[model samples]
Target chain A: MSRAWAVSVAMMVAALPAWAQDVGVVSTEQFESPRSGGIIVRVGGYKPLLDDEKALNGKTPFKDTFGDSSLLLVELELQRYFYQGIGTAGVGVSAGYGEKYAAAKLESGVDAAEQTALKVVPLGLNLFYKFDYAAFEWGIPLVPYGKLGLIYSPWWVTKGTDDEVVDGIPAKGGKWGWGATGGVSFLLDVLQPRFARDFDSGLGINHSYLFAEYTYSDVDNFGKPGFVLSSRRWMFGLALDY
Target chain B: MRLTFAVLLLFASTALGQTAPVVNFAVPGASQGTEIVVSKATCGDTRTVTWSRTGTLPCSSLVFWLSSDSNCSGDPGDGDLVLDSEEVPQNNTTTLSGTLELKMSDALAATPNLSCDTQATNKSYRVCASTKKQDSLLACDDTASGVGTPTIVFTLDPVAPLAPAVPTVTGLDSALSVSVTVPGDTSQMKVQVVELVQSGDDGGTPTAGAEKVSKVQTTDNTVFRMEGLENGKLYGVFAYAIDKAGNQSDPSTLATGEPIPSNGFYAAYREAGGQETGGCGAGGGGLALGAVVAALGFWMMSRRKLS
Candidate 1:
């Protein structure tokens, strides 16, 4: 009777794999969604290198007035993947805004009643490459990307309600430059594979990721001796592929 | 045939028995139940009172008058002031029209018995009109029947509102910000700025210079910014509350501020020998770049759809 009970237990153990399979517990590699383009929403700290000019003679006017604080820059970038085989390559366009406000300084070096503000609108066009192949095939869930871009930043200074004018020149202009960015994204689908598949089927979103990037930009009109709007900053944001 | 003749005879008697004409009074450019503001600025302005009659009753004239009573019911020998007597000529037309021009000063002068010295107070009067038949005014005794009379209230506010509190002045670069606590009865506030000329002698008080700038705020906002001032100079600031009648109150206690030079970011950049001139850099280049990017995106989207 003990030998018969051992046989019954052995048969039940043999059918366990088949039972799990029948109950829809399948691997994520089976279901795949078509991939196209991606959208990224990012924010970063940006402070233009205004004191780097040689004529300033070691005087940090920007730091003296606004102090050593970085403005919070929020950016939105859109990329369309034209080639998407081993990796994805696309041209992206991004726009961002940042501003800093501080109490204006008087001629006596004291704080004034009115506020002075420095505002910037940064626009960029870039060609990007994302090595997302391992994420889809090997399920490594980490995608590394690189971007080379051209940037044009329009900046303005305001005192009170009007544009600040000094020596008959209005304080508003744009600077042109170039930048390079490198970032790594972590796939969110690996944490919740079933919900990720449902999201794909329901909202047409193929994948989602959280990413952080570092950018090195030289935005002084190709170093033509002007206001150096260049900066090196790190940005963190979410990325969505559809 | 006898019944038809009797009906015609009754209609003819009813038409002939109508002795008084129906009158309606309207003030041009003024809506119903709105108070008209009379001030020193508009003292000589005239408001036309139009009356229209709709009856062929052979009325001699239309008598128009102003009375403090809402019904215009008091005896004419008392406070009732006759404005105009427009003669109605005998004509074939059933509708008769007349206009009475009421000058604001004349209206105020006619009602001397009423108080006009209070701040923002309404002095009301009824614009009454009656059709005259052989020098006898019709419907003048019937106060209960409110048919042809329209009441118009005149806000004769000749007194100024209470002065505001002393202004709190802040010095800025080539400007001064002044704020005051407005009185409850104030409708508007005015801020006046004057530059102060300091005496060359030591410890002498600064004398007031010519008025530099004045700004009137018509909103409930009590803050004013006097701009275009010279830097490194002292200035006096004063605030006054104004009533709805355009009467300005006495100036508040004197407050002073000193404008100073303020350095902004652009100024700092220029001081650092930045070569970039402040303007649109490379005109139209930014716009062209945006257009190219947008076109490329649309083309890529269409290609995806085709595939």
Candidate 2:
């Protein structure tokens, strides 16, 4: 309909663009239909800077006053595609688990620090789309494309180390947020000797990709949504399509 | 006779050229305040003396004192030597070393318990001589009236407490049990745990989710929690042990664990603290070190400790 509307649609696809662009294969093997769909999964994590977590609120039961804890992230994306031959879109859903943690503070049990840990999870649904430009005619042998997705990360609840206290602080979980993401995707074939001739003859194809995205979340520290949490990152992953 | 003469000479030198005793104090941080340790507590061989006009205040310029109590107390011995009423000589740091051995008839006539050894709270005391007896006024900050009565510092018997050997972290997530064995003389020791994480090696561009392992102490073992880990993501765990007499050892080696890392921590805690009963399902794992690091070994079995 419109350029903005189109971009919004592209961001709703759930395929790991990096994977598809990096290792996946194209459907040059005479497909039954001009469409494709598959699954994408990733397990990874990151650490937040001291400055960022301090922004969460007052104090926490975490043993570390400094920024030392780390986060583990696991995600699942179910992707389905249509309209192939360089031009197509994919739709998918995702889910996963993760946590944050720190070690004990003091040596003695009396004034010692406790090893605090936090977990993050995406408890919501997702949708997305992508537009791939054919790699045939142009000198550019790699296929290039763009993507957009809408992620509804539901309220994340925490568990374990419940009775732990850091300077009289208890634990707290967070609310859900609507995340919007958009980025680029590419396809690169693996240099397997057996597939070389077939790959050059256009008989076989592989998928690989790189994508950058921005995610915004909501914060209800003061009992109301007053802050928006945001994270931006570039990821590399692969997905197969036929 | 010559040998006796030589021994005498050595003794005389030792007596005449004594070294100034070192004053040691503990600054527990600005929030904690300073703990002063006076040296050579006994006064020199003088009976009575006056404070010099020239010693700089370590913290502030204001100074005050009681004829008796060297302690920072508002109360002191009943001695109205009347401030500058009697100006003792200066250049007499030696004469000023101990308590002013002056008799106080007027002091006893007034406040009976006016000892110079009284101690006060949060106040610094110093002795100074001025032309006017009243000129020997106490100064608390720039305000002369704020100095509640006078205060002093007195020497106390030194009782040194021996330090205990350090302890170590014994376990992670799932009842981290920590065992600490100190010498018979060791006093109260404390223990704690904290989780940390760092990037793996970059030399070979290692894959994400790789873990970094730290040290642990375990003759037998010392454990803290059982299965209290962050899921999926890697972790760095640590511990510490301290003795009762305030002897603290450095933190112990760091262990690693991932609790339900597939799911996040806050989410799980919320579920646990709220709806789900110990929803931190038993699917977590730990990176155990060795038997020595009892705390480190628990990394393998991360079953839910809550439920």
Candidate 3:
């Protein structure tokens, strides 16, 4: 009668939704699974490196020239793992909107200030390589990953220098351009819970991850001379994988 | 004895019919240093001359005259009879005192057949009244007003029209539709269109000559149909507004476009945001694509164990 009671309780628990991973003892196999495929969504912020001394507004920082700016980034990606924990290749599309740069006077003694904006919407095809140091019993729970990708981003400068004109047209905004990007992200798998033995064997699902990544992008100016749209920033966000 | 001498002098002045009347005289609408349009619709413009007696002495005859010369010394003859009390009742000192519409033909009647060059040329007028005969007592000529003399100046334009807006050129079959903003009223001004040519020299300094493509007489139409343009050759267009005074305003900004047929590929090229930028070279596109493909292939090969 005790054995039957134990069997019934186990069946009831297995039927429950896997809202969280079990917190059982972690093994190296979790990082090396070969059939993992899922989606990740993240929201973060970035700072523009507009203070390159070679730029037109070199003497002034981006925030000082355009007054109080914030760059907000939102990304959605689909990851297809060929080697699961060993390699994860994905395509991600990200949109970033920089807040209106503060009003600035194009001409001296003019009361009306010119307001400008910057935006970056990039579609990236990236390959991620995750190191499996845990498989060698390194005891380190942090998984380090490297990303390399080609970024096709449509960028814009709503208000540009007053004197800049291309072929009688304002040289402010244009079509999508090409760029290359590379970054490194440290995956914090240490915080993940290991489920009890009853839920150990199943399709992997319902995961929450915390990560921090630093990226550098080198973008072309379409045809604008003496103008560079390259930017670098560190991002921190939460990614839900399923 | 001194009182008797004064009485005799006054009697002699009255007996000789030279008793000059104290009359206040002016040419209405005639202001010192003010310009007047003389040859707009007719040979000369028109105005009125007014006169009044300052004292109780009734002046029998008052005359208004103009002289091409500033000095009123010579009798400018019958042509100078702008008005006379004997004819026009407005010349009378009592009844609103004489007022007559004065034109260049009537005022400068001495030179009745003379053609006036009404281009801001300064002249003069005079008003004289006598209590008796032709001996005038009160007279105000251009010189009588000192440096602020009421001179007769003729002009063609009081003000010039503003310049037209920059033109936009679009290619059509065998011609171009040049669009621009209508400056103002069509009746007051005419449009001047010029074709700009560049020699393609190293300097590339554009020179505009008497190469008039077309003249748009109507101000109501903003689009000028420009023809005789060479296909695929770039042309710069400019516009100007000529006022009634023959004052041509500065030309509008240059609008450069190449003419094309309806079926031409380059016809829509200019409208396709082609200005100020060339496409990424073929080499650039190929290199970027190649790099992406190469990186993806190498990455996939390194992880072939799972595949």
Q: Highest lDDT: which candidate?
A: 1
Off by over 4 Å in 3: A1-34, A43-45, A50-64, A67-70, A85-99, A104-106, A109-114, A132-139, A159-167, A171-206, A221-226, B1-307
Per-residue lDDT of candidate 2, residues B167-227 (tens digit)? 3433333334444454332233334334443346554422223323223333234433434
In the range B1-307, model 3's lDDT, one tens digit per residue, is 9999999889777656433345455555554224334333343566555555443333233334453443434343453443443232323445435554656545444555543543343234443333332324333332221111334343334344577778777654445667777575223323333456566878586655455476655556766777776766666777777653355667777766665533111112223322323333333453464356446545543443331
- Weakest ten-residue segment in model 1 chain B by summed lDDT: B137-146
Residue ranges of candidate 1 with Cα displaced over 4 Å: A1-35, A137-141, A188-205, B1-112, B115-159, B195-209, B218-221, B272-287, B290-307
Across A186-234, the per-residue lDDT of candidate 1 in tens digits comes to 9999999889998887777789999999999998877776677899999
- List interface RMSDs for the candidates, in order: 2.4, 16.4, 13.0
Reference-based lDDT, residue B158, model 3? 32
The deviation in Å at residue B177 for candidate 3 is 35
Weakest ten-residue segment in model 1 chain A by summed lDDT: A25-34
lDDT of 1 by residue, B10-49 (tens): 8678656655556676767764244565565655677676
Q: What is candidate 2's lDDT per residue for A1-242, written digit by digit as tens?
A: 69988887677554467657767775543322222454455554433321234334543323233244445566656555544555566555556566555443332322223444544555333355555554333424344444443332222223234544322334333333444555554444433423533543453223434333434333222222222223443333454443
TM-score, one value per model: 0.67, 0.34, 0.34
RMSD of 3: 27.8
